[model samples]
Target chain A: MAKYYQPEFECMALEDMRALQSEKLVKQVKRVYENVKYYRDLMDAKGVTPDDIKSIDDIHKLPFLTKADLRDAYPYGLLGTDLKNCVRIQSTSGTTGRRVVAFYTQADVDMWEDCCARAVTAVGGTNEDVCQVAYGYGLFTGGPGLNGGSHKVGCLTLPMSSGNTERQIQFMRDLHATILCCTPSYAAYIGETLKEMGLTPDDIDLKAGIFGAEPWTEEMRRDIEKSLGIKAYDIYGLTETSGPGVSFECEEQTGMHINEDHFYAEIIDPETGEVLPEGSKGELVFTSLDKEGFPLLRYRTRDICVLSRKKCSCGRTLIKMSKPMGRSDDMLIIRGVNVFPSQIETVLIKEGYSPNYLIEVDRVKNNDTLDVSVELSPEQFSDTVKDLAIKEKALADAIKTMLGINPKVHLVAPKTITRSEGKAVRVIDKRKLHD
Target chain B: MSVKQISVFIENKKGELAAATRYLANHNINLRALSIADTQDFGILRIICDDPKATETVLREGGYISTVTDVLAAEIEDKPGSMAAILEVLAEAHVIVEYTYAFLAPDGHAYMIFRVDDNAVASAALAGAGIKTANQEDLF
Candidate 1:
């Protein structure tokens, strides 16, 4: 049977949910305009004000917030509530420039946890379950978000952060953890470790897994499910909004259902910022309807996906979002062709190689050169160099078919590509360094 | 009739060949005979080592993609056309040689390693021609 943590919000009627979102958005805009000078100035420059935002329909009248705006605001410029009211902060794992830091008030944290709780409940979590949160605990939001949500769901939450795979499995088996939460790569690693330790899915009591914080292919999802003997669910969120639990997959597993009551989602053409109609594939934009500490209006998520309002079998009236195709930031334009590492990954897994691989892009004499270094597993290794060359050419040809651009494929030694414990780093663009 | 040869895949980059050799040297593995086939991007380093199994294990532990294959190793004359005569015999037998390399033994005997399409046919043809071929034990 379908389950929900907050059935009232999860199964709310479309009209009622929109009414609630509009109410929250109006109050949120005014709160940001009055409290945040950065947003207030942006609103003035855009010729928008609190009075202009009468409802969610008027949200387009307000200016959109980008990562650049957050950078300009820095540490405290965008805080909507007083410092005394702010209780916690979570930071992004951004490697370039400045890391984004999001503040949260007590109420804001409660709301975020409630979103996560709904996600856990959707995956069949209950008070009888034990939840293991294996996402990194520190500044990364994955751990804390799921941890709080598991608590809210009354599951015996395992605060075990990421790493120490042996210990993770130890506790998982000893405590009979029913739900696991972490990035998709980590979940795969755990599954790999389980095999290395001669443990099978039957030995563990895990029933479900919540994997996110990075893009993963459907092939990876099936692989994880088979290895761990759990139905893997994808969760979507960003620190810009409130860690994870922005949206989560229900039993339907088609797409994640957005918590429409709290966050209003809009798909916009990334180039023009024009809002596209429902079911359109475009960049995702979110407005934290009632976040008190750092209320952002129309924050571009940079994730490309389509949203559907089709009636779901999960009995949730909330809209569903397809798994992000790729982040606009993660997309690489090489030789005038746009390529995502996830697309390359899908090809790799399909070709019977581990998802561990490296993509190197460089510019030579003004021409972009793409090199893909893939790890050769023992099963694929051959005695004849001619056979190996044929394998490499076949892989390169397959990738060229997928990307519409030829790439030099190098079959490296197995386990040479770095294993990701959190989000995998798959691309190294030498072109950027030269620029 | 045939001996085990370890072939390692190394990228066509500076020090990759040196790195593979250094790994073998570090593991105390000795190369009895070795040959390299190079292309634009990578090279296959084929070696008849003192210990084929140990060399493979060390190379794998060093994160090198390697595989072992059975290749006919026949003792040949040190003079010119020694390889051509062996090749002519194999050609007459219709045993296609994929790749071949030669090295001088410490005892002053020359040996040629021939990777053929069918090792058994090549070995029988070479034996029938009165040419002596080294087995895995004889190579060491």
Candidate 2:
């Protein structure tokens, strides 16, 4: 049977939801225009004002906010509420360049937590269940967002962060964790570890899992489900908007239900920025309808996906967003962490190595392996294999420090990587993720 | 002085060793000794050829990565304890051998090549033990 955290909000009629969203958008626009000078200047430049946005229909008139804009307004430039009222801040786990920091007021946290609570409830989590939060803690929003939401659902929350798979399994077995929340990759790792320790899924008591913060295919979901003996769910969120739980999958795993009351989403043509109609695959853009500290209006997500209002078997009237097809940029997600080829290039240049390199990503035994083949500079190259191996280890360590994930580095002969006339094919992702 | 060995990196694929040997054979190069140091992905085919330059040139022209490395080579008696006695001296001198390979020469003796961390120190240790190292011409 289908369950809901907030039946009144999740099953609200289309007209009523639209009315609620319009009122929230109007209020949010005025709040940003009055307090945020950065957004106010953008609105003025686009010949838009708070008066122009009387309803959600005028959301198109607002200028779009891209990642570059967030970088430009780093720290507190886009904060809608005063710092005194801001209770917490979450940031993207980007090690290179600037990170997108999102501030949250108490009410913002409450609403975000409520959205997550709905996700947990939809997956049949309750106060009697022990929820294990294995997403990374600290700056990354996955752990804390779900942790807070699981607490709101009154579940016995396990605040265990990512890593230490052995200990995670021990606690899962000892404490009988009924619900698991983590990235899909880590969940897969835990499931693999569980079997390696001579324990089957029958030994554990988990019933469901909430996984997100990285894109995972349905094949991975089924694999995890079979291994962990749990129904795996996908949750969607961005640190810029809030965190994981901006939307969530219910009993019907077709797509994640967007918390439409809090976030008004639209699909836009990435090239032209024109709003695409419903069910069209394009760049996802979100407007925080009821945030206080950091309210982003029409923020471009750069994730290519579709939105549908098709009736769901789970009986929720909220619109659903299809799993993102792929990233519209050069960013690649390896082992549930965002990795940009430019980040690797930055490390290479900083280490006084040639910037020409090729990244080969492959999935072996349900784990993503990153192998980087870089051209050895003439000065760094040596006849001794020991010296070359040392250089490779040094470069690999530098890249790991930059990306927070280890990569196998191979120092090849100079001018080895194939160079083309146009944009170089720097990344060769062999993982057939979509298939 | 130690012998100069030509090392060609062979990717772990079928027909790679054949391709490397075919290039050397086409150039009329005779291999005095050859050994392969391999891992999962690739292997290093170390060879003491009749002509190191020609072997490297042919391999390079055939799109193979080849390098010339100096390694200590000593001709020992074909008896079992002879090679062990030479290694015992190097171990007593605290000289570490990175890798070693042996081949039975046509002259009824076993010639062993040792890639050591310090070639000079290994040479002195072998000389101290009355084992004279071979030069490139000696191998040919």
Candidate 3:
């Protein structure tokens, strides 16, 4: 049986959690002030004492730690604790600048595994279920994170990393695996392969899928579920937040319950630094409470979403968050306006095509413009004369609904684009000003 | 003996394919038999073309991701029972097809290009069965 622990500290009435947060938060501030030079200097530079964070509500007064801050701190600068205690470190190859490495102690790993166990359990996974992990392993946090959690849940786990689709299917059928964890793109590929192989959903006993590590659409969810004959669930997290269990979809299927016990969530206006009220969309920020090796305070996760207090069908009393729309970094500034890749995605799916498209932002002269690229299905390829105008209108209407900005839609043939095995590249921003 | 087949990565979107097509069209290049393998994010546009060099030049100039590769094109009898015979030969020869697609040929035979399980063995097996397969010469 998989042992699970719901954070009692989080589910306690809102006031108690806040009280606990304030108390633990104070200790963290003092720990950083006394040991970590960067944070101490930051506080010194601001003329703020650790005692200034008097209440949990005073968190807004603290400076937000951006990815830039992480880069400036770099390597050992961010760690408040000693390197000796770190059991593991996971990171993304920081193509933007400095590689973002996060340290996890043994206790931190245990907690991460517990959270992942909750993710597996939330979707009705049990000891009897076979959890097949296909996310990339090693430096990438996805594979090992879920592997540990599946083991914690006592499920028969396959530590298969991504690729080798044929062998993947063979193992899937051979192990009689029930749960799948991988990127949404890989899931779709696996699903497509199963269909190509003439294997029915009944051919293998797949029950649930926990997909993440890349952004996907509801249409994609539908496609995956239909192909695999299973319920598809989204798991959310980044390497910085301990991989794919920062929040996860419950049986309710509305949104993810932000495990508010181990971590606290805040949504703030990216430009003004003003915290948004509940139900308002803003950049998500985090403050780790229980994390020991390298707990972060006000870590500005560029992911944008709205917080909700609405009670979930699932019994969990944790606060819910709308599925992360997209990252702030991925937000496009076209003609002096901001746009997100997900906005285009929503429109594309609603327009009834597989929401597979790319946004190319370029500066011709001093003005910025966007070129939206899409793939056309074989069904639509029958009539070049009639279908062209209809498909274009549908796509244009979708752009109007989602982006609040019009973009030129270019229709390409299906399979004309490169498929990313990891994170789907959504935008090719070539605006010289931004670069 | 060669026809050049180029694989271009494109998003499944409106105008994207046309842009690639128009670029090639402007260069007076023709797509002989093209197929796209699509997923949600992107698909690879595989093309056998009359002007592979010109097509690659145009595609690159148009800022598209493309690569040219060699693929075998086989002649299949365009009849109901022909496919069965083709598969039986491969089955006996212990050869596999990774992926395959068909195109109509002018002579009334179906030309199928296959990504084979074992390229050398499949080529030998098909030759042993006396099935006429198109090499690079037939492609151009």
Q: Which one wins on DockQ?
A: 1
- TM-score, model 2, chain B versus true chain B: 0.93
Better of 1 and 3 by TM-score: 1
Task: Give me the runs in candidate 2 sitting further than 4 Å from their true place.
Answer: A1-3, A34-38, A81-84, A192-202, A349-356, A375-392, A410-421, B49-66, B104-110
Candidate 2: residue pairs that collide? none
Q: In candidate 1, residue A244 scores what lDDT?
A: 87
Candidate 2 TM-score, true structure as reference: 0.89
Question: Residue-wise lDDT of candidate 1 within A1-435, one digit each (tens)?
Answer: 339888899999988887898898888888899999999998999888799888788988888998888988888989999999999999864322345789999999999999999999999999999999998897778999999999999999999998899999999999999999988778888998999999999999999999887666677789889999999999989888998899999999999999988889999999999999998989999999999888888999888899999999989999999988756677665543447687788889989988889999885533467999998887787767788899999999888877767999988876767888998889988764211
RMSD, every candidate, angstroms = 15.7, 3.2, 14.5
Tell me the lDDT of model 3 at A241. 70
Best model per lDDT: 2
Comparing chain B with the reference, what is the TM-score for each candidate? Answer: 0.95, 0.93, 0.83
Weakest 10 consecutive residues, lDDT, candidate 1 chain A? A91-100
The residue-by-residue lDDT of candidate 2 on B37-132, one tens digit each, is 765545678899868877777876766667788999887886779978988999988888888889866666678899887899889989988897
Find the 10 residues in a row with the least total lDDT in model 3 chain A: A378-387
Candidate 1 docks with a DockQ of: 0.32
Q: lDDT tens string, model 3, A1-435?
A: 422345363256777777887887888788877767887787788788888998778888777787778878877787878899888998764232445788898988998888888888888888899999998788777899899989988899999998898888999999999999987767888888887898878888889999876555677778889889999998888666787788888877888877777778999998887999999999999987777777778889888888997876666777888777756786554542346677677677767667778889875432356788887754444211233556776787668555545677777755555789998887897743311
Clashing pairs in 1: none
